[model samples]
Target chain A: MSVKNEKKFNVVYGEAVGAVAAHSFGEPSTQMVLRTFHSAGIASSVVTGLPRILELVDARKKQQSPIMTIRLEKSYAKNYEKAKQVKAQFEEVLVKSLLESFTEDLKNVTMLLEFSKEKLAQSDLTLKFISGKLQAKFESIETEQEGNKLKIKYKSKKEMKSARTMFVNMRNFAIKGLQGIKKATVQQDDDGEFYIVTSGSNMAGALEVDGVDKEHLYSNDMFDVLKVYGIEAARNMIANELKKTMDEENVSVGFRHIGLLADAMTYGGSIKSAGRHGIAGNKASVFARASYEETVKHFVNASVFGERDPLKGVSENILIGKQINVGTGRIKLAIKKEDLKKVDAEK
Target chain B: MVVHEVLSESEAKKVSAEYNTPIDKFPKILQSDPQVIKIGAKPRQLIKIHREDPTGKYSAYRYVVESV
Candidate 1:
């Protein structure tokens, strides 16, 4: 079989945008975030705008802007993806650690405060230290807006729960530095760390006992706003790419179609599946055989697994859908030699 | 002299950038009586943080960046 004829890989592409980097995620957080990574770009790109992420990165390095390349020896853990994962992992670890430390059960952990890994204006040891601390679990973290103040609803559990008790616990936790936080001139940790919740700056090493969480923070749109921002900011770039792709391939696709394609690309960069658990619960066979089994676990109800709905509602393909053994119909692939020869002769 | 100090995961990076050094090449661990060898007159590729200055900055001590 010809590889190109295979539908294993669906290149769902998107454009890079910003609230600023022309169309990259370099935009500040004050801007609106996209719901799904702009899909409208990639479907068009191979057809108009540009190529895709791989191609986009290539074009960027070739640009005449002196290539804003910062040479670091071995800091692979500092990229947007790695950093975001690290932050997320840290939250998990922090909560688990805190629960273990306090010998208490875990609560509904929420990332009350969030900042873009790319938006930090400057970085230093101090910022890293403080961030490391915040990434540690402090019980309950929620994003709330109170007039102009960003009320980071925090609830810790080294003890009991009460407004005054929570406040006192929070205040005490503030005073005792988490070992190696950064020192600031007008330290905000005095009142708390929530005050320093500014964008384009890392919260590491910037906190002290004197810091106030409220003082440092402004009204945040959402904790995971950056997630949307990063995806949406790619709108223009997505549009241009989709335009190019569709035009080149002569495949007319609307913004909605491109949007679906973009979402797949941004998250996993494939367009061969759809529905609720399409990418989340189960991956297609193309991803890997292991992915197929995972998909089975995600969709079908087996004796091993209780009854479950396959998110394959939108991903049903009759030609090669390897889901069931015997359902409404049967799939027979054992072809005899005579049938094969007869079919070949007809073709 | 090689400035040896503690750096956060991010600062550890900026420090390397400032020095045009690779992160993998940065001094990270302490050896028990580390075998110090002088390769010609060039300095040793080592960055050790003093016990006191674990804050990752210029502390009350001074050290030379030497090569083994």
Candidate 2:
């Protein structure tokens, strides 16, 4: 880049870019409605509007509803059937889901589970596969399979409470698919490419699926992205997420402002909230930290540690009613000791 | 994600001198970060990142911290 162009693009020294970015976000955010949208009965409802903005900025570990969009490889992307196969790997199928009816013989200490043929056929699972899984999971229990019905009996006599516990465990036992993923639906994009949308996110596990487009696999969960990709990717996700949320609310904000905020949050190698627990709490000036939140705690700690306020930041300087070190206030003039000595004390 | 490259000892020293800042004082990237692990960078090392924006491309530096 040329020096002139670089100078034009460069942020002015001591410019209050952070303050500007904060205001940019804060102003548009007030107009956003507190609404979460549900997409029919297939995909999960995403938290949007003001609540989502707060969640992203706060760096909350657990999102209210995490979702993933798993794209497919070139060959699989055009066919719905092929996409369904990939989607099946993520939709968790439990033992109870395959059963037509479940009955327990309390006197004989045996549980009879009748498998639904239609459910088994739809899931592409065989009777033997389920029986084998059951035997592997419960070693002490002996399973007898006759046709589509399987009978489970305890090796030793157990109390009613123990029998009930065993019944509940057997009913909820997972047969196939990745854990943490509740549902996966194959949806077509605007480009007519088939992609899987899952209610829960498991990026690592989703990547291991056969036809998944690993490069394009995206999760709404920020921490999951951090774990699978890294800080830089997380930073991009933050900016993109913020932009997307605002767009959903029909609010337009400059991407530069959002990018600046995202950079501030993740530049420290980890996602830090903009609130008192993160950026504000870690300020260098004691007065700036005290003025943010937990006023007494900050002052007490500063006193005990004998901390000195640099009075360089805007907040600290403002607190003492001084010109903030920004824009024109950032300029200072200095005269060398030799130059001063050259002039007489009094004219 | 942007491309990341681990700086050699000499290069790191040169960067420190150019920036007039200590190596440890730069913005940090965790040692366990996926990109760091991919490039096999150790703690206290320096990473040069190449990022693209709407304006153009730019380079940023990060100091590899053990955690946090």
Best model number under lDDT: 2
Which sections of candidate 1 miss by over 4 Å?
A1-258, A263-315, A319-347, B1-68
- Give residue B8's lDDT in candidate 1 (0 to 100): 48
Considering only chain B, report the TM-score of each candidate against the true chain B.
0.34, 0.91
A76-191: candidate 1 lDDT, tens digit per residue: 22243433322221111121112111211224322222322322232211324433444364445444433222234444533334544543343234312231122211212333
Relative to the real complex, the DockQ score for model 1 comes to: 0.01
Q: All candidates' TM-scores?
A: 0.20, 0.77
| lDDT accuracy of residue A49 in candidate 1 | 26
lDDT tens readout by residue for model 2, A36-150: 3332243536776777888999999988888999889999999989998788778888899898998999888899999999999998999888889888988888888999999
Interface RMSD of each: 23.6, 3.2
Off by over 4 Å in 2: A1-7, A33-44, A94-175, A304-308, A336-347
